[model samples]
Each structure stands twice: as structure tokens, then as C-alpha cells.
Target: MTAPHTGGCRCGAVRFEASAEPHHISYCHCGDCRRASGAPVSAFVGFMADQIALDGKSLKTFENGPVTRSFCGVCGSPIAYVDERLADQIYFMLGAMDMPAYFRPTLHAHVREQLPFLHMPDDLPRHLKTSVPRPSSSNPDGTQS
Candidate 1:
């Protein structure tokens, strides 16, 4: 079997491994993501929840409505984001990945909420809202295929 993708919090208080290749990758410019990551934009790698194993005592979670975000309780490094609608999948913060450079975002989400000063000069497809379709389970990539 291939080696699992690995990552951890800044202080080494939280660590995780994903056994499967990511099914989706994208950049989110929504205000919620920005506030959660404390960055102008947040990139994520999405994997089936069952494929991820988080091993750490400092993992904590915050819930707002249907969204629950996980972070390192010790270093406060953002970890993963999950939405009730997409409960089967977990979106891990790209910045927390051990090899963030290996994952390239395929699209940009919530473009309408993107900060005016943040200019990404890429030809990636941009969506005004979440790229993932709601009430969806099998197609996290937001593609009809």
C-alpha cells in the first residue's frame, strides 16, 4: 500500500493521516473560511471521512450552525472543516498538510465573498458559492460526471 498523507498542527499537538488520495481540492474565499483560517483565502483537500485518522489529544472542535471546524487545542492551528450536509467527507486545511505543495487547487469557491485586495492570477474555475453541490454525497468534485 502507498504511504498515507500526513500532517500535524504547528505545535505538534495534533496529527492526522489520510489513507486514500484526496477526492477534491479547492480554494475557498468565503468569509467563514477566512475567519476560521485567519487568512484571506483558505485551501483544502477533501477526503472521505472514513479515510482519515486523526491521532492527537489536542484536537478540538467548534460548531456554527451546520458547520463544524476542528483545530489544535494547544497551538490553535486550524485542522479540518466539516459540514452537516457533507458529513461523509472532511476538508483538511491545506496549510496544515505535511506536503501542501503536492496538492494543487482545481477551483475557487465563494468568489463573491473574496476580498477585493486578494487577487489570484490563475485560470481556475471560480464559483460564486460553494463549488460542491448541496444534497450530494457521491460527487464532491461538483462535476456532473
Candidate 2:
């Protein structure tokens, strides 16, 4: 694996580099992840927090309990998600990576919450929910006022 992999927000306002390879990569289908990314599924690469370096100070964070999601303040592009319970790691938003192809999702999480219109065409393992409980949601995605 490469010593350093680089990526940034869509508008390039928030840049970062990860020195270590990810511990795991997967597609998160939880409602919180979907809403945060504005996508059907959110792909992420998890790594030790100490291995990543943020190039700028343009990161704005939103918290849901112990989990904090970071995004580019200028462009609203999701950057990373940190679960305080898992303090040693950071989940980098895969779409924000300069070389997304380098990271392949190995499984699917929160499969029960996946949108009806979405489908997983691959044979990756699917979990009814993630190993850790996601923020529970009684409302549908994008429907809350």
C-alpha cells in the first residue's frame, strides 16, 4: 500500500492526506450516512486518526451523539466521520478521495435501512446493521423539515 494517499473536498477547500492504508472499507447504508452524503450509500475508508493530516482549517463538523461528521465549509462536501467511541480512527469519505478506485468496499452495513430503489449488485457481505449502532431514525431520508 502507498505510504500516503491524498484527497480533498469537491471545491478543494479542504484537503487531506492519509499516511496509512485503511483498516477497512465499506458502504454504509444507514439513514444518517445517506442523509449526510446525499447519496444512496456512503463509501468510507477507515484508518487510524493519527495517520491522517488535514491540509487546511476549512473543515466544519456536525455531531450526532458521539459521532462527528466533517465536511468542507465552503462546498459542503463530506470529508470524514469520527466516532468518539472509536477515537483511534477516522472514516474518510471515499468520494472525496483523489483515487477512489484504490479503495474497494468489502461489505455493506445497515442493509436494512437501504433505500428500496437502491441495489447492491456485488456479492459483498451484508449486515442488517453495523457492528456499532447507528443513529436510529424513524423518519425517512430527506423528509424531515
Candidate 3:
């Protein structure tokens, strides 16, 4: 595995260190993700929550359906997305990483909601929703496959 990954908010108010390597890196085209990052799509890397140590009293969260998004209260930089159903993992926005290029997304999720004006230049698999193995619970992002 590579060296420990470290990152923080834009204002340096929030910081985190992850020992374990991430899995299921993805480009999410879901509306919630777009809204959260103010981008047509958002790239994220998922790691076990226990593998990370987060700091910053300014970190705040917004629970959206089954996911809670954490960010820096001062800079409002989107930090991570905690999925309630997947209690063991946390999804950190790829762009927030100090070494964002280290993580390479392998798939696209929520493609059904992708905007017509947006397009990606990759041949990775695209799923209507999550590509991560998930319980058959109703998908909070949209319809289940």
C-alpha cells in the first residue's frame, strides 16, 4: 500500500489521516453530490471509518437521508460522506485530498440522474446507483436496481 493519506479542508480547519487504503473510488453523478460540491459530478474515495482519524472543532455535519455529509464550518469545504446504511465506511471527496491524484475512481454511480450537459471521459462501469455492495434497502439517492 502507499503512504498514509492525509487531507484537510480548504481553510485548514478540518484535517484527517487515513491509514488503510481506500476502496470503491467512484464518480457520483447524483443530484445530492452535485449540490454538495457545486459540480456536475463528484468523485469520492471510500475507506473504513475506523481507519481514519479526524480533527477540527469546526467540522460539522448535515444528515441528508441515509447519508451524513461533513464539512468545515469556516471554509465550508465538503469533507466526507457517512452513509448510515454502510455504518463502517466514510466517503471522502477526492478533490479535498492533499494528494487527490492518488485516488483513481473506477466507476460512476447514479448515472441515471446524470445531467445531459455533463459527460465523463472514461470507459468505467456506470451504475444507476451505488456500485458498492449494499443491502436491499430502499436507495435513498433514488430507485433501487
What TM-score number comes out for model 2? 0.88
Best by TM-score: 3
82-120: candidate 3 lDDT, tens digit per residue: 877787999999998899988999999999899998878
Candidate 1, 74: how far from true, in Å? 0.4
Error of 1 at 137 (Å): 13
Candidate 2 lDDT tens digits, 1-145: 5869899998988999999888989999999998999998899999898898987688899999878999999999999999876758889999999999999999998898989999779999988777444335323652221
Candidate order, lDDT descending: 1, 3, 2
lDDT of each: 0.91, 0.86, 0.88
In lDDT terms, how accurate is model 3?
A: 0.88
* Deviation in Å, model 1, residue 45 alpha carbon: 0.4
Q: Write the per-residue lDDT of candidate 1 for residues 107-126, one digit (tens) a residue.
A: 99989999999999999999
Any runs in candidate 1 off by more than 4 Å, and if so which?
Answer: 1-3, 136-145
User: Residue 46 error for model 2, in Å?
Assistant: 0.6
Residue 124, candidate 3: alpha-carbon lDDT: 95
